[model samples]
Target chain A: MTDLIERPSTEAVPGHGAPTHGDDDHAHGGDHEHHGPSGILKWLTSTDHKVIGINYTVTSIVMMVIGGAFAEVIRAQLVSPTNTLVTFQQYNQLFTMHGSVMIYLFVGPFAFAGLANYLVPLQVGAPDMAFPRLNALSYWLYLSGSITMLLGFFVTGGPAAFGWVGYAPLTSAINAPGAGPDLWIGALMLTGFSAIFSGVNLIATIFYLRAPGMTLFRMPIFTWNMLVTGILILLAFPVLTAGLVMLYCDRHFGTHIFEVQGGGVPLLWQHIFWFWGHPEVYILALPFFGMVTEVIPTFSRKPLFGYKGMVFATLTIAALSLGVWAHHMFTTGAVLLPFFSIMSLLIAVPTGIKIFNWIGTMWGGNLVFSTAMLMAIGFVVTFLIGGITGIYLASPPLDFFTHDTYFVIAHFHSVVMALTLGAFAGIYFWFPKITGKMLHEGWGKAQFWLLFIGTQVFTVPLYIVGLHGMPRRMAVYPNNPSWQNLNEWSSVGALMIGISTLLFVVNVIQAYRKPIPAGDNPWDASTLEWFTSSPPPHHNFVSLPPIRSERPVWDYNHPDAPALAHGHHETATPPAAPAEQEAHA
Target chain B: MKQESVILLLLGVFFGFIGVVYWGWGHEDGGGIMLLGAFLLGMLPGFYYLWWYRKSGGNRPEDRDDATVADGAGVVDAFPSTSIWPFVLGSGCFFIVLALTFGTWLLVPGVGLLLSALIGATAESRRGGNV
Candidate 1:
């Protein structure tokens, strides 16, 4: 059978799905190097997007464990009244590295690199990523950047404790001097470059690539989300790279880019950082948005609700997310409250559309409560709460009370942590397809519940303590009876979140230990990705299948519907009729 | 012969234009910009020709000319048997990551992997006498 499959002349295979000009125009175009070794060699040297995707997932999981450990240490220190478990310096380092690692090292890269690596080419109907060698380089650069930043901890004076934002003066050599911030800046600069190059590659691929009849309008929601995400990276990362360069200059050289004593503007740093930082927020979340599009449609057993609107909303969010960066600096006292407030509130308009669309998608559908769906739903609820509190933070009046408090922590953590959960949800959902094996479902679900409850318990009370004038990044609250109880509750919640993380780890290990065979289209997804074998071939498709709609695989697998008018049809039978009938009926 | 080289040439021209704009800004430290510009100017037409042959509706024989693959090179499509360059590159990456994190000792292995891969690739490709 395999030989029969391989017997077709290469000329017979249709190439990229560009609008077929004539009979002779559709011969296969791409030529890639194929290598051997079924086991370790495949993983070690493979340029296949699927292999690269697994590498991303494995690396991200490792970082998450490391990030979560940092969280636990922070929680343990905060559990009791005035517990000097860790020194003040140590506590500062913990939260700062925790924030930086989780944001840059874990969520940001994992969301884009992991899902985009696996899904972008499949969604766009390409054989593989546009630049396969470049794709490998992105992964390597990311791993390199992550390791460099982490290595800062082992260096003298520990990692930069100036918070992930690395606010000036605090990060400046005059106030807090060390090799720590240098490592942080250098690592981020490297990671930023990785993201920029990958973004360029993805953008060029999606635009120039795609199978025939796969019009922009007909593209899947996940692909659209990534398209917008790629644009965001191009625009946002350069500003960050510039900012990092200026920062490097200030730190290493005697440049006064942000040096207060040297007549440098601290707020300039804020402008540049947040310009990238705010978009960084969406860069982190948009992939989750993309994943939600995938999960919600599959679990709800419907095509995405308002697909075009969701795409528009995603772009809107990406654009608006850029303008609202200053809202993060409301506490900095130099920002214009009215302008930032308006922009921040305006963001909710597009965001509201997204929430409604997700809910609309699930409404009156089968609504399978898989680990993926739970996480998507979790994203909506958590992000909604995060968004609402964000509006409060946007207001100068409300922010005056909550500024630098645990309230701010609760707000951002809700959004970013929700992103982490959503990413994990995607990893679990797609793990079977990518690995050609099933992750332990029982462990997966248990992990989900733990994180859900843990997030609520741990982060919600930070709001209360925040309102009671308790600041963030504080090692110990000195004799504040009012703050003690809520802090303890938060600690307990943190512990649960930690346990949930362990469950996920256990699930990953167990699944790898005895891999379950997941056949092609395990979820019965309608998109083109599911049409191929589990862990798709290095060159994605063999014969370019005829795609008439967004859901080509579904169209093909359905038995009832007539085949679309496409030349170079390989299979004699119309295999898609049954699924089409079932869907319509 | 491949599309990538042509694309790179086109990129060179476009980037050269950018270098021109930077040079016009009269920044004295524009040597880097001008050098990049010179490189790009030298590469444009060659790239344009290559892209025309591969992608554009070109006047060429069907069999002898490069035949464009379908949307994806569909399932079971054959190509050159796998090469070891990617693994060598991966090894280079592992060492680079280690060197970044641990110390300079790891840099030696990374450089070694990279050089060996480069040399090995160059030698093997030359065996086909393509280069």
Candidate 2:
């Protein structure tokens, strides 16, 4: 294993004219393996991060479709009062699967693992991830975990319908007696391990594998955010792992951890799960935060404002995220109010700072409202609403009123849905770089607006419905006069969101059908990734261009201080690197 | 003290720290935390070697393929031709996932895909074809 990288081997440098040395072997970014699929075996044995990224993406998309279909079923069931398009069992399963897939299986993994798989090494100027084989293992584990979950749908009694949270007493052996909850527990455990492994690999890579002269301050904001996110995962995932193990023991081995009659505390499950769970909210949102940070600067044609502050803010969020886990449990009545409220409210500070930084980044620059920017900007709006609403939820007084009401659903779904949209904006923005094929812009914008309007139309009304006393996750409600109009409007919004997603699928398929050229730097972004070829070569860099700032590629392109060295040595600080001057200026 | 070995060792150490923190401090159930921490101690060299590589030298393109050799010495060839193992592993992944998602019929194909890819790709790599 030491020989894998410790001992150097002889080979001719591909593009560069120089004869290489042992140190260069580890540094040279090139294909150590097949770049694209050549044969059946190559496809299977592939360890390439890019290939794995695509796989994560494709799998998540399929899951998205399945999840969306479930949402559609939910909507269809609620189109009118007392309508039973599906049985209650089916309804429960549908919502359970929908939430589970969207959060655990689809969104977080797709963004973190998928985006990190594709970009993290590139951003940090590494040839590949620190642990490439482990990277492959993470993907495999995730697939298996997802499979274990989907298999429960085919079970005799049906899948776990206790909701994605799997709150106990409900999920305990007695209330939901079956293999259904077992599958959910087991499958999620598998996925959880996969996430932890990927997080560790990514963190190690960023920490250890940076190119020469790429200091911590010189790293891109996206990379910085990922680094913090990685730490959060390291801290957050193990607890979830412990919680799941306990849950599994409780369900299968007759352990009375959450069994109320057996001297178990039901709230313990909430505490344990939310320990991992609340950070997960940021785990999901922070990547989107990174995405918007990348988008606003690139499209606005300005250096990201408050670069160091942004990094600090991101880290602050990760740190503060741990304290706020109890916010999710306020409605349970078991939470310690002042402690939970303070933690929750403190979260708003960093979050608010991030939004300010983003707006500041876009204040005055050559704003190119590309489809990516549009979605990013949209994320700013939607997330602000989500965050503002989050403030209300933080107060125990307000939460008491909103608890289990449509308002809580409205608040959370806005964050989840909008953050996802932000991620999609990032995907569409970077899709070209990853695929070396341009995604259709018109269609991309089309998908964005449809989703944007759809989410607003659907989620906003839920607030009114909640205030009117409509409970969430419930299939049937009496058609009270005030509730009548809001539910209909909400259903209408759900359809729009659905249609928008359909458009997105169509756009992705069409973009793939006809490849369009996305040159090495489509957005002219300053990050290290833009320095490489679109669909970067198997080994990412032939030359680690003299990096004076985090945006080494940007320096390379600028005429006055063009990137100096294109080989193994780091370039000395240039006369006036924009990253340095702009950061200070 | 090649950078690569140092990195591997360093990784082992970091994992050890994580093991202690997560297993030891983080959990109330400390049953396996110590053992897991001990196991993580094994990954130290890998981390150390990785660190050494980044620290010991500058980025010289001329030395890019020299990774398999000792720093500034030896004739070990590091830049072996592209291995297909990861791809095969991924395909095996596809099949396994397929089998899980679709059913047992898919399992046969999945296993076939996984086995053939792993065996063929790995066997060939060990035979020194890419190098």
Candidate 2 residues lying further than 4 Å off, grouped into runs, are A1-39, A561-585, B1-131
Residues A329-427 of candidate 1 have per-residue lDDT tens digits of 777776656666876888889889989988887877666677777888887888888889988887888988898889999999889878877887788
Residue A46 of model 1, lDDT score: 56
Q: What is the lDDT of residue A509 in candidate 2?
A: 82
Q: lDDT by residue for model 2 over A1-585, one digit each (tens)?
A: 111322122322323332221233444333333334466654455566777778787887778778888888898787776777888888898889899988889888987888878888888766677766667668877887787788888777888899998888788877787666777776787688788888888777776666655666677877777776776677678888888888767876778898887898888888778877888988888888988888887777667777777876887677567656767887776556776688689888888888898888787666766778989998999999889999999999999888889898899888987886888888877887887777777887888888888889888988888988788888888977667678788888889888888888787788788766776777767787876677776646544455566566666665354333322222222233223112212
Candidate 1 CAPRI classification by DockQ:
incorrect
Using DockQ, give the best candidate's number. 2
Candidate 2 residue-wise lDDT at A130: 70
DockQ (Cα-based) per candidate? Answer: 0.10, 0.11
Docking class of 2: incorrect
